[model samples]
Target: MRKFSLYMASICLLFGCEETIDVELKDAPPAYVVDAWINDKMETQVIQLSLTQPYFDSSEPTPITGATVTVTSEGKTFSFTESQSGSYTWDPATSTDRIETVGSRYTLTVNVDGNEFMAESELRRVPPVDSIKFTFKEERNAFQPEGYYAEFLATDPVGPGDTYWIKAIKNGIPLNNPFDLNIAYDAGFNEGGNIDGVVFIQPIQDAVTPLNEDLDEIVPYKLGDSLHVEIHSITHEAFTFLQQVQIQTQRDGGFDEIFAEPLENVSSNIMMMNENPDVQVIGFFNVSSVSGRGRKLTE
Candidate 1:
């Protein structure tokens, strides 16, 4: 009788171990990062299917190796070849060597490791320059009783959000860098956080030793001084961040997984105008808002 009982107990233990080791199924697709951009000096150009590695929180970016990417437009097909693991180059000879025009639509298809991805975007057009003007600001100084500030005002007649870049040239030679003046604040409850402003600090040169008695010898910004203000063509980093979050959330399953993405696209686009390149416009501005309220905190 004891032998019989021992045999039953052994059978139960063996079955319990098998049950604990049962296989579980996961239905999630492999995550990937893809960065597509137009090459420098060419506005109508697009270099697509460049696989960026998965970010700190993102799934590994989809690899471009052995992947197929094609763009079709106006009856012409352009193909991209993966030159390396995550980067693909277009062959101008066979690819459509053309510029994407503003207001025109384009489609792109990418197949990586048998997974397909696609998107469409319009070549945006910026409004022509209406006017570039400046104004003076007043502030009290810690070293002096009073101080004067110089500020600039720009308009498009059409309104704000047209991206603009500022470049300033002082004393003849063209400055090497461009300054971006658009300043954005984080969304806060009380201040609306949407109010836009510029912060500028001027550098004062020391008076020459044994200098002349003329304290009124003044230097002024002259007209035709080559103040290069160019309309910026790059997509705003904020837009890119929001876009990535939207895409990741749509693809991911868990709530915490969806919230792990970063909130910055800070690619030299958010710098003060008074620094290195002297304050010239290299871009335009176009302000837009996402209509609905953000996701609820309770859920």
Candidate 2:
């Protein structure tokens, strides 16, 4: 009875120390977000414009409509007409549609309500995806039961300063998780690694494989599953921006993230035309050369 009384008293003390404190956060103005990534694929290109919302708002982003968008490369301008709310698109007529000379800078301009925003990017070269192979595996654990695992194969170009974003699509659905983001600098990660002119490292080559339900590493895909992989060459600035975004969004909750530094806003390449920049633009613009290949698991 004495011990039970002490336990009750301890629980009361612990409960008494807990109190709900409402954190009053200051309101900040909204920033324009531009998601403009053009690739040299025989498909329609799209650019989405939207505004940022409050930190705690769980609603959809407010789209910016009635905006004029265009891209110019090698003295030739291609207009992007508004297709729907906040989405601007440009269609390619033929498979051999070439907007302009490669390796030249492409400038993007957006006008919204008399305010102008501009960004520039160069279409970098990309290497072809060689193949996608599947390997059979036995039941390893609950997360990774017996299934077929896939591996993407691609060789980087023989030049440094080349960066790529490896995109994986499973059964037509893109693997858009932050942890699935696979960006490469030359043949390895980051610049100045002295690694180039070779095949992509093992980890990157296998990035097309899907992750388990926990978003952790596990064997993904099975018999009759389909996988598509694409490599999109990106600019250095875009690479940096994506790197920062991945770092900020990819949190698994552990000791390493416990002492992590406070989150900072990722930098953007888009700039406004106003003298004081009344409305800031936060996003990246990149033109890329892409190579992709698909495979279906049958074994």
Query: Best by TM-score, which number?
Result: 2
Among all windows of 10 consecutive residues in model 2, the one with the lowest summed lDDT is 93-102
Runs with alpha carbons beyond 4 Å of true place in candidate 1: 1-30, 43-63, 91-96, 127-299
lDDT tens per residue, model 1, 1-299: 65765466556665763223333445333334445543223323334343333234366455446777666556656576676776766755453355345544445566655455554444443333233333232433432222221222332223223222222333333333111122222111112433222221111011100111232222223333323333333334534443343443333233344246544322222222233332221111122211111111110
Report lDDT per candidate: 0.36, 0.84
Task: Return the TM-score for each candidate structure.
Answer: 0.38, 0.89
For model 2, residues 28-140, the per-residue Cα lDDT tens digits are: 78989999998877789999999998888889999999999999887677788899999999887732346545588999999997788999999888889999999888888
> Which consecutive 10 residues in model 1 have the weakest lDDT in total?
290-299
Clashing pairs in 2: none
Which residue runs of candidate 2 sit more than 4 Å off their true CA positions? 1-21, 94-97, 141-144, 217-219, 254-256
Candidate 2 has an lDDT of: 0.84
Instruction: Point to the candidate with the largest lDDT.
Output: 2
